[model samples]
Target: MIRDILYTLDSPYRAPLEITGFRFGKGEKTVAIVGAIRGNEVQQLYICSQLISKLRALEAKGAITSDNEILVVPSACPYSMNIGKRFWAVDNTDINRMFPGYDRGETTQRIADGLFQHVRGYSYGIQFASFYMPGDFIPHVRMMETGFQSTSLANLFGLPYVLVRHPRPYDTTTLNYNWQMNQTNAFSVYTNQTDRIDEVSAKQAVDAVLRFLSRIGVVRYHCHNGFLASVIDEDQLYSITAPDGGIYRGICHPGDEVTRGDLLGEILDPYTGDVRAPVVSPTEGIVFFGYAQPLVMEHAILYRIIRRLHG
Candidate 1:
């Protein structure tokens, strides 16, 4: 089920890089699911591979019922994947940050341009990603204002949190924005932490996607109830900073729940044998995320709190 497409690039390097996709079912609606724009996010690529294997089996047996198209790009950044780095080999640049792409530019731009061209015809575009930087994430999907289809897909994906965010000013060169400009339905699903495979985030992503496929009628399946995590608005998210110094963190993980005034962590001055100050939770809600490294500094974010907004 692996179909390799070589996009011709203007380079002395003759053979085009092999981009692989798993094609399944037959329909007017095509969904291009891509992963590993950042080489470090091998987990996303792995998830895509799993999805393709299942879908391909269904296709072979005639059990695949979706009239819609599902094209899976398991790894977009091959160079990065090879080097175990996050950027392209020619010049170390972030592929995700570079959107529409330039034909006359470097490797990152060329790849973006190539990717944009290949996915332009799709009805829905999904980009799977994890933090190219390592950290725990509250699983979420980000949809662009221009992506009506993406918004719908985000809901269908049924992730715990579906957030509609404008592509940051710096995100113009990303695949998501390029899909938007081409009138292709596009959205991005992401988890926190980079360079390491997080099984929890991967499963959460797959779960959301399966729910989405079912909701769109692209596939038939029974989704377990209570599948989504609590989706919160960005405005409701607040970060608690370390006021003092020392390795400070309380008994809290990324997804733990906390009440207001709960002791989240503390900064200590071991040299002076002093416990500088304790960082406390500001609201009663879930601990959406926190820093992982131990060496602390003043103004370092210890935790991000998502307060329940009163309606």
Candidate 2:
């Protein structure tokens, strides 16, 4: 395993912060895997570490295919992680939103620029991504609907779902979108949680990456076939919103199958224990995402369900 310091930011009063990459093998076709871009993505970092460990063992055993390079970056924004902030601690900006960036621009942009320069032009790019809102998600692989996107390529991971998202204007600056614009095939892998680690899902994520590597001829490790993977577009998801603000008492979790009008959860009065609103499923489907926060705000999105298309 070769450790490369891809980018470094000097601290005014402390040690310089570095974005490090652990590279394996030497070759023309490269696969770049990125872990945590945000500070609070504990599960993302943990999954990458497990991937790195497995890759290291495979490398020692001569399982990695010759001339195929794989790079795993465990953490990119360590400063924010150390300080317990989500975005760049200095300017409160997201490094992910500044991708394919400018070296002479702001701090986060420069960091993004420096990192992008090193990882671009790869055969495949995998980012262990986190959701913007705090919640739980079923393990899936997501791709922006860039003209270059290939759902067949995403299915190699064998995750439960392959989500194709229509990119908004702001998405043009994101790493995955920018990578596709630059002629690289990029996909984002979303595990179950963000701030905390879930061992089952983390291992599932690691196995998915290994499965991809094996399928692409980068590695020769034997592994089980993950999932057949359902391909879904973002618009097909039905969102359930909270009607009143109060303490959330969730009865349904992500991955649960629910019938239409089933009682999913209830918002309760914090002091008196009276139910403020009873949240129910609007359609027969599987839960794709569930709001995990204990407190609920009025009109906030509480759940996203993948509705069945047929009766």
Candidate 3:
């Protein structure tokens, strides 16, 4: 195992910020795994760390293929993580939204550029990604609907779901999208939690990565065939929204099955504790995501369900 600083920026008020990467094996740039572009993505960071640990063991045992290389970057924005902020501490800009960045643009852009220079050109790119909202998700592998996307390759990870999302204008700046544009097969792996570590899901994620590497011949390791991933388009998900702003009380979570009209959750008045609204499932399906925050605003998305098809 080899550790090196992939990128660095000298900070005026603090120690120099560095993005570190861990490398295993020695030849082709086969796979690159990234974690925690945002500060609050503790789960993402944890998963990357676990991947690094596992890769180290594999490398020590000569399990990694000699002609393939794997790079694991555990954290991209440690400064924000240190201060408990989600975005860049100085300007509140998201480093994730500045991908394939210009070197002369801004702080976040420069960081993105520096990191991208090192991460791009790999055969595959995997990002331990978190949602923009605070919530829990059913573990899945997500890919942008860029012309380069390959669901067949994504399925090798063996996660429960493979979601193909249509990219919006803002998505063009994201790392995944940019990597795809650069001809790299990019995938974003989403686990259950973002701010807190979920050991079960973390292990699942690590196993998934190992499975993919082994299947692709990047490493030699034995792991169970994960899941025959259910390929779903992002548009197929049913979004359940909050009717009123208040305290959220959820009766179901991600991966739960629900029927139409089922009372999935309720919103209560923050002060009086009276039920403000009852959030119900509009279709019979599986819960793909559930809002985790105690408080919510009107029209906030409470759940995303994968609508089940019936005869």
lDDT for every model? 0.71, 0.92, 0.94
lDDT of candidate 3 over 1-311, digit per residue (tens) = 99999999999999999999999998899999999999999999999998999999998899998789898999999999999999998989999999998899898999999999999999999999988877889999999999999999999999999999999999999999999999999999999988899999999999999999999998889989989999999999999999999999999999999999999999999999999999988899999999999999998999999999998
By lDDT, highest first, what's the ranking?
Answer: 3, 2, 1
- Backbone clash pairs for candidate 3 read none
Q: Clashing pairs in model 2?
A: none
Tens digit of lDDT per residue, candidate 1, span 1-311?
Answer: 54757354444663456566667777764688888788777777877876776667666766556467777888877766876777776777887776677768877777777776676788788888664333466777876665454444566677667665555677666777778787777878876645666777777677677677667667665677434445455555888887877866566877788898888877767676467897888888777767777668778777877776567
The window of 10 residues in a row where model 2 has the poorest summed lDDT is 25-34
Question: Which segments of candidate 3 are over 4 A away from where they belong?
Answer: none
TM-score, candidate number 3? 0.99
TM-score of each: 0.85, 0.98, 0.99
Per-residue accuracy of model 2 over 1-311 as CA lDDT, tens digit each: 89999998898987998999999998874799999999998889999999999999999999999999998889989888888999998789999999998999998999999889988989899999998877888999999998999899899999989999999988889899988998889999998889899999999999999999999999998999888899999989999999999999999998999999999999999999999899988899999999999998998889999998794
Clash count, one per candidate: 10, 0, 0
Q: Which pairs of residues collide in model 1? A: 98-173, 98-174, 99-173, 99-174, 133-194, 134-193, 134-194, 135-193, 156-212, 160-229
Error of 1 at 306 (Å): 1.5
